[model samples]
Target: MARNRKSVARLLIKAPVYLVAAWLLGFGFFVLTLPKAIPDGMTPKSDGIIVLTGGAGRLEAGLKLLEAKVADRMLISGVNPVVEPHELSALTGAEEALFTCCVDLDRAAPNTAGNATESNLWTQTHGYQTLVLVTADYHMPRSLILFRRAMPNATIFAYPVKGEWPMLYLANEYNKYVFTLIGEAFKPAPGDAGKQAKSATGTL
Candidate 1:
């Protein structure tokens, strides 16, 4: 009993070191795999810009890109329906016509999947074959999953917005990735939201 107790105590001491090492390795992997900068010459010629709103700086980044002529039009997903276009223009400091002409305030979507559905509709209706997806750097991976599932045929290019802090962004990216993996493993099969979004958009 005494020897067994010693062995268990030793294991407990070593367990924390192992856990710490594993976490550092996982974080390092995520950082290494993350895209350092926006890809060169990724300007989409077929479709408009689809900006998913979640991170603090995502919308501002998307608007700046639009103002720079990165794409012909912009779809700001997850917008609050009550906010007026003129209000957005005042917030962005761009002309109201810029928002009215080249932008659509999508209020239906409340998440990434919704962003895909709404943006897909906007793109298809506008006859755009290609699209540039803008979101925070940490969100690009999961965003790709939802977007690809929503718009299987459309060419998609990711234009990740720079985050405020590199460490925080990396932490968020890996945390979301792990959470999603676990959620997929144990969560019951896809239900109404995903199915309805997929069916409504017809993204087979």
Candidate 2:
């Protein structure tokens, strides 16, 4: 009986230790896989570009793509509501005409999920099917997951803004990415989403 009890205790200790080891391994893989730079000699062009705010160099990265005609139009999501077009132009050192024509602003998105939601609406409004998604490298995984959930039918490309980020910041982002992965994994496909919404509305 004592031997059996010892085996059970060993199993219990091993299980939690194994779980921690697996989690650390997964986290390390996530960090290592993050893009360090856009590969050399590779140029990605899309019909549209969407920049998620609250990241270093993300806006500038997307704006450069837009200016280079990488995409015909660009959406700068999560802009401060009070910031005017001309002011943004001055801030980015972009020509006013560019904002007037090719650039669009979304002042409502309060977070990454909101950025995806707003980008989807802008996409449908503009009829842009292919998009270049720009955000910080550490943020790319979660952003891609949310973007795919939000715009499943659209063709999306990732353009990670490379930079050396703090380890704590990276860890936080990785945890969010893991949770997002779990939360979004079972979400119904795009077609099912539409039907679910319609059914709810009908019940109402």
Candidate 3:
């Protein structure tokens, strides 16, 4: 009985250490697998483009793809509710005419999951079967997972925009990415509000 009690106490003490070690290992794998840049094989051609909000230069990249005639339509999901359409046109240096006919701004989605859900709806409305997803490289993994889950019937391609990021930023994003993966393992469907509390904080 005494030996059993001692063994249990030892196991309890090692449990947290094991967990921390496992987390560090997983984080290392995540960082190593992060996309360094958009690969040459990932062509720009798709029926539509999905530019997830909250990252610098993502909108411009998507617009450029559209301008290059890779995609017929572009959806800038998760646009701030207060941001006017005209303001986005100016910010992206895209002609207002493009926005008038080809681009759609989504202010309803507040996070990656919402972006996927709303983008799926927009694609269904437009009948776009193939889509290219654009977002910061650090965020591309989680975005892809949620997007694939949300639009399983749609052919989706990843177009991660690489950025120079500090280790802290990478670590923080890694945690969120892991969290998203874990949540997705059990959730049967994509949600409209994956991170509602983080909405006001921006860059959810």
Candidate 1 structure quality by residue, lDDT tens digits, 1-204: 999999999999999999889988988886767655575455555358888876777777777778778788999999887988888789867888888789988999987768888888888888887888888767887788777767778888888776565687678668777776665567445364677788989966
**Which sections of candidate 1 miss by over 4 Å?**
1-21, 39-42, 166-169, 181-204
| Per-residue accuracy of model 3 over 1-204 as CA lDDT, tens digit each | 999999999999999999999989988998888876665545657899989988788998888888888888899999888988789989888998998889888999978889989999999999989999989988999898888988888898888887787889888988998888788877756453555546756863
| Better candidate number, 1 or 3, judged by lDDT | 3
C-alpha RMSD (angstroms) for model 2: 3.3
Question: Which pairs in model 3 have colliding backbones?
Answer: none
Candidate 2 regions with alpha-carbon error over 4 angstroms: 1-15, 39-41, 193-204
TM-score of each candidate? 0.71, 0.85, 0.86
lDDT at residue 89 of model 2 (Cα atoms):
82
lDDT of 2 at 167: 88
Which parts of model 3 have CA positions greater than 4 angstroms off? 39-44, 188-204
- Model 2 residue 11 lDDT? 99
Steric collisions counted per model: 0, 0, 0
Please give the range of 10 consecutive residues that has the lowest summed lDDT in model 3: 188-197
Model 1 pairs whose backbones collide? none
